[model samples]
Target: MILTRFKKGDLFVAVVTATLLLAAGAAALIARAGAGDPVAIVIVDGAAVDIINLRDARAEERVYASALGTCAVAFEPGRVRIAAADCPDQVCVHTGWISRPGQSAVCVPGRVAVVVRGDRAEVDAIVG
Candidate 1:
């Protein structure tokens, strides 16, 4: 029996192809596992107000608290937005819905923060 040997270039290409396939498979698994789910919105005043089992949310819904003031978080298919706010700057309201994991909107004056929580934790920082 005769055995065929792979050249250096052929071996390199095979290795690269295997690595790519593995990476693709891993990414697909991650995406499937991290699929979207219903998230609760916690409005913190002097006391914590929990809005549970919220499936669909609208941009028109305005959230308010005595301590945190007023702010609105809009919900889309895969995201949430800050539609309005009682704060002077209104920056938080402008931030809009953050669908990705680890995304947040904060209104200091209103003492309000909206964050998207997901199953997989995201890295704190990304370096290019």
Candidate 2:
């Protein structure tokens, strides 16, 4: 019975669904295109400190930053991580490495943060 009624309403519904799916796919592609590439951004005390190009960084680098005390940032290839921190919890240091957009390690006590972003880059965690 239901299969027999697919002449008008069902066709409209199917067309609408296909259109919606196509629109969604196109929107996703546009967003990805606008995002460009992932970059490492370091923020300290609500300020950006460094913008690093992980793609261009062949040699591993250790970045030392001092805010409340001290923290070490390291990166290689396409990933960034917090190597160590003098803060009490050391949570930031345990975040390991991040390579994808939106991945981040934040130390509230030290006011330090490291994040991988899809566009642009910034640095942070420098007191002086």
Candidate 3:
């Protein structure tokens, strides 16, 4: 069998590697869980039009008019999504709901972007 080709030391190394990967994944999940509530930021034409805290947001839809067309954003208690858009490509709507921090849905043709951000001050990007 293929498994017989590996030595005892190889099996030990594989087990250790798997254990470390699991531990790292668990740590990442724990950190995200404790990072505080997440908020969704709606940007139109490179300007923030709305910032809704997902924890306290109501179930509703907000529509905005953009340069290319209009778009609708739906907000739930702990998630947000782009429901509809008039752009040619419906990529944003296809993205579905996003409840985690750092998730985003963008309508390039409509010039609209919805980004989810956590309360924790994590460096989103470095521009140099």
lDDT for 123 in candidate 1 is: 58
At residue 123, candidate 2 shows an lDDT of 37
Candidate structures ordered by lDDT, highest first: 3, 2, 1
| 1 or 2, greater by lDDT | 2
Residue by residue across 21-108, what tens digits does model 1's lDDT show? Answer: 9999999888867345545454555344644323455434556654647776666555676788888998887786676556667777
Q: Is candidate 2 or candidate 3 better by TM-score?
A: 3
Candidate 1 off by > 4 Å: 1-40, 46-48, 51-62, 124-128
Can you write out model 3's per-residue Cα lDDT over 1-128, one digit (the tens) per residue?
86879899999999999999999999988877755788899999889999988989999999988877799999999999999999998999999999888888999999999999885736574355
Measured by lDDT, the strongest candidate is 3
Cα misplacement distance, residue 8 of candidate 2 (Å) = 32
Q: Which residue pairs show collisions in model 2?
A: 42-123, 42-124, 43-124, 44-124, 44-125, 48-123, 49-123, 49-124, 50-122, 50-123
TM-score of each: 0.54, 0.62, 0.67
Best by TM-score: 3
Task: Please state every model's RMSD to the true fold in angstroms.
Answer: 8.0, 7.8, 9.6
lDDT of 2 by residue, 12-120 (tens): 9999999999999999888777455677888987788888867765656565565575778888888888888888999998889888777888887888888887653
List ranges where model 2 is wrong by over 4 Å.
1-35, 120-128
